[model samples]
Target: MNFDLPLADISTDIWDTKYRYRDGDVIRDASLEDTWQRVARALAAVEAGQEGVWAARFHEVLANFRFLPGGRIQAGAGTRHRTTLFNCFVMGTIEDSLDGIFSALKEGALTMQAGGGVGYDFSTLRPRGARADASDTIASGPVSFMHIWDSMCATLISTGARRGAMMATLRCDHPDILEFVEAKRDPAVLRHFNLSVLVSDAFMVALDQDADWPLSFPPGRTVGNVRARALWERIMRANYDSAEPGVIFIDRVNRLNNLGYEETISATNPCGEIPLPPYGACDLGSINLTRFVRAPFTPDATLDLDGIAATASVAVRMLDNVYELAHFPVPRQREVARRSRRLGLGITGLGDALAMLGLRYGSDASLDAACAAMAAICHAAYRASAELARERGPFPAYRAESYLAGEFVRGLPEDIRTAIAAHGIRNSHLTAIAPAGTISLLANNISSGLEPIYAYRYQRNVRRPDGGLTEYAVEDYAWRLYRSLHGDAPLPPGFVSATEIPPDQHLQMQAALQAHVDNSISKTINVPADMAFSGFETIYRNAYALGLKGCTTYRPGAGRGQVMTADQQPPAKPCCELPGAD
Candidate 1:
């Protein structure tokens, strides 16, 4: 890979403003190379011996943006920022009481203060108008409490703290779910939260049967019932109109979870890439696929499978080192991270790589290429973790028999599985596909994880120190690279934008990759504004049928159109915002 390549203007700006470490008018990272070196040094310090050897290897993987770590890791690692290396956490379950709620809120505040996004499952709270057993007071319900959290996040952002990103999930069976589904209808409410409904297998069955579904609480308290199909339509309509709340197939998420036997998951990190149990946390990184492409815009184009495998191996080790170097916001979060040692390693530049290889984004050939690339990364990461376990010890929570029996593990290559059985794996779950928005931008505006190019060129608003927006022109990395090579030439058929691809193709791309991902994925199925309601609903139905853990979609000129329009401009947040992201 060419490490001497110059960064695009936007990439340079992103690095200088968001990632470069500085102290009291002194810049710690004088250049992009310095930033990579700083992070490499910090992570490699965790190695027992060969710190110098590992630092060089880590730096090599990071150079030329071949591997992009999560924004939190890029900014906080080797810095005096007093922040977490982990990007996000599923906070401990809300306790369903005033004290419990406030305590959880404070924990969230602290975690955010430490530069981590938070997720919460609000299903435990009683329904609105329900009387508390102990105090006999009318409960304000979960949505009401979410307002407090929303305000808190806004307050943090106001103070120039890390950009506030949060996910709030409510169970479909919750009596107050109706209100939760409509919470974002006003467009001005809960601006800080990304909401999702926890759809259970039972709920899908009810919808399939067109039967009445009970809205109930714990201990068999039946609040009321509604027509299942009607409720399902409401959810689809809410998303069709407002672009949220997304749907999480909660049953599938838990059942397919590698650690399902040990924990129950109710919420996901801000973008839904990782569905974590209470107090669960994970760090993230991506393999830039464009770096592995052997040829460009020619019949000889091919992916360097071996190179991808090698990078993935090094990336796993680097992320594992983060566990030793990071500071967790809470004791319980640290405990969970140490026990699981979860890492999210995915791919970026997928769209560009596909186009560079002369393949369409959603075609069968592209799907095959995607599966091949993801498989190499996934298997390589597992093998590396197993080797690390042999060198050090496995994660404290690893149980050889149960872990191997997991649905995802059972499908791994026989050799990888055999290795895990012999030497326990260092990480419970190794692969997840994040939105990778900010880091992808920092990597010269490469295509994000498993997503097509959002646009070839668009205006991006960068927030200034004075709280104003500065508009800058941004171009897709592959487009610029191609233009530089073949000036004024028309793009190949493979070059397509997010909206240019069919909605089913977007879902298909995600589904194809999901088979290899042990953790959930964060992908937005982009639908044209003219797409029919029935067609829109099929995307979710198909996602469930395809066995995806969750689904999020974005429709231009939808209810959020007031904020996100159809002029090809990216969303104020294209995906999950990274810590310190604009």
Candidate 2:
């Protein structure tokens, strides 16, 4: 069967370079149809006598860019490569001892070598200048050891393997927290790690009251103290000068976790979407919202809610099947994965989808539309998982009482909750909005994840299989589609790029979706370089107030490099050093 081919050059480039199946010199995926069929057949093989029936369903969802699996699944499924199907993993904690640190480092290396990104909570390490009780030796803090891991990641990437993405998280109260926050000030240091402050509720309250906050470690050992507001100001100033350490509401993450009863989430998979316990991995896929928009750019524009629901259901099954077929890098990862089958089923092309509906993103009307669409997808996904549980079985970690008591679950529709109580649920957690940057490009450069369009047109640099960079002229999906329809007509007011949206509205959009998302959403609140430092700090404060799980922002001239430049901006040579980027 002939499926619609990729409409843009970048779409074809991403597929061929990132997702296409190849056996050395031989290309197995001759076309995108072959790629989709290959993945569908592989995943459906685990369906127990319903392979043909389910394969067709999977293919239909995957075709036409309607649903996109994580890059690992698309590239490794049904192939001979011994790589994981999951995109990322939160590695087991880094033990403070020498042996412990190296063991965790080895695990990260293996995981990355097998084509999966990794996240690590470095708060376990002792503070710099702290004397070890047993060894009577001075200890280097988490930030110091991070350099070792950074070197390891750089070495792996230099070896011509897949690009490495990692997230390193430090508790806001850790004695070395200040150093961790400042470690990335130099562009050349820790290039492979995306750092985040694991901000607890206590710290926020302390900041509110202008209290002196103790920097404690090793359980109740106060190594130092600083004014809470002062520390926060330092964080904000660091980010304002150089967009390094993003903020994560760590306490809220655990509180809202569907598996909170069984696990403590201190770190997230790279890109801050899947907050995972040690050894936990995320099986991710995204339903393309653009494909579900009906009569786009017309007075009758509306999201095809039924279509999204159907596609989301099938996407869950496909992600669940990934567990059966995946080649986990470590046995512990596989063990944790089987116990709690986590699926990050989210949406891509949201910006374009909103624009297609003639609703400006971050507007009140757009928030309602986004909420309604996410609600449909979220509930539909839950219902699908429950049905799978009855057909197969609940995930090993599922405890009906504890699961039902979760904040996110208790808020679900009664019928869906009832379904879960009666028949269990296959996946422990079901929704996470990822930075689908690369996959969105594969889908004709639709606005990525929940972000507004970065620009109507830009030059995107894509890395070739041989490690060289190739630049492509890319245009927004909605922009191109609208041009096709109206022949260079003036864009409506609904079309707004990322820079044009206010930081608060960006937070609002994320907060609106976070209501339905169990796993966190990966959104970068783009702010202008000239924004006041005080105003910059308020964005993080607002994120906490608005109950967002985390927040990241990018300024044009920030320390971090860019992958693309708008037509009006100065040209930028593409850089792949971004860790949180998809």
lDDT of 1 by residue, 521-550 (tens): 888898999999999999999999988899
Task: Give the C-alpha lDDT of model 1.
Answer: 0.87
Highest-lDDT candidate: 2
Candidate 2, 112-143: lDDT as tens digits:
99989999999999999989888999998888
Q: Report the poorest 10 consecutive residues by lDDT, candidate 1.
A: 573-582
Q: TM-scores of all models?
A: 0.96, 0.98
Runs in model 2 lying further than 4 Å from the true structure: 1-6, 579-582
User: In model 2, how large is the Cα lDDT of residue 533?
Assistant: 82
The number of the candidate with the highest TM-score is 2
How big is the positional error of residue 241 in model 1, measured in Å on the Cα after superposition? Answer: 0.7
In terms of lDDT, model 2 sits at 0.90
Backbone clashes (count) for model 2: 0
